[model samples]
Target: MKKIFLVYSFLFSVFIFGQEKSGAKQFWENLQKQCGKSFEGTVTEGATNDTFRDKKLVMHVRNCDEKTIRIPFFVGDDKSRTWVLAYDNDRIQLKHDHRHEDGSEDKVTQYGGTTTNAGSATLQFFPADEETCDLIPNAAANVWWITLDETSFTYNLRRIGSDRLFTVKFDLTKTVGTPAAPWGWKD
Candidate 1:
């Protein structure tokens, strides 16, 4: 009876972990398809910042590895933001890397969240983690997400229990000129 119980437990745990890894792997692969490509985007919704709306936006899948992917997000000429996605076993973490003009880290750099569950291949949600809340108190209720489909890729943010919302949609059907390296880095 004891041997049977041990075998059952081991198999159950393996099954659960395998399920978790599956979704993350699929999502990672989907994003990897855009590696080495640059896409033009627009602020489809959000009224908090007029500057964002007026500027041209671009996203470049600059680097991708088995466990990490870095995407530089350009706003007109401001290349301060890079979205970092990292995978560990079956979960994915999303971090925002903000840098200064001199290749120095910004005050509010490296704020993001980790996945609590295996999200679908086309979409994943990242709620503000403890680090993000500590970095920006008002962002305690923030939730960021990305969605990739046949036609477009969208980066969205919503503040829970508030009216704050921002969404940017990138056209996947076409490619654009690659933007310069983000601040704090050289090509």
Candidate 2:
């Protein structure tokens, strides 16, 4: 009877382990499912002393997967730019291929961010500035803090050592297949 009990325990352990593994996969999958949606909002003024004022901006997150996502953002008449964001194990990374409106890359940038357990997302800034910036090698900022529901995330940008804060929010409900407009605008 003892041997039988031990066998049952082992089987139960395997079942639990399998379930946990699949649970994690499902969580990531659900996050990816948030892609293909377009969020219309304004890029509020950030904590910059610069003259960049608050204006309307559009953000489109699409082609999401466990590995990568395509984020295209634009404000006003400025040309739309696409960012390829990838999840490298624990880090969310972006390698800029500065493509012009003609689809040719003008320049490239290398940057990425680590995910926190505290429900915040941060991306480190490269080509560091000389003033008011922290030396943590990695300056962390809140990606999205305010939200009315789980499908939405709002981010207020606060530069390190600076008094400026900008507000930006994303709504995940507009997710549809790639729209016809350049910046994920509707037909």
Residue 102, candidate 2: how far off, in angstroms?
2.6
State candidate 1's TM-score: 0.87
- Among these predictions, the greatest lDDT belongs to 1
Q: Tens digits of per-residue lDDT for model 1 on 1-187?
A: 9999999999999888755547777889989999999999999889866588989899999999999999999999899999999988788899999999888999998998988887888888899999999999999999999998877889999999988889999999999998888998789
lDDT on C-alpha atoms for all candidate structures: 0.90, 0.48
C-alpha displacement of 61 in model 1, angstroms? 0.3
Model 1, 8: alpha-carbon shift in Å?
15
Which digits, one per residue and each the tens of the lDDT, describe model 2 over residues 65-174? 66877766655555445655555554444433244565554433322233333222222222222221232333343232232235564544454565645666666655
Pairs clashing within candidate 1: 103-184
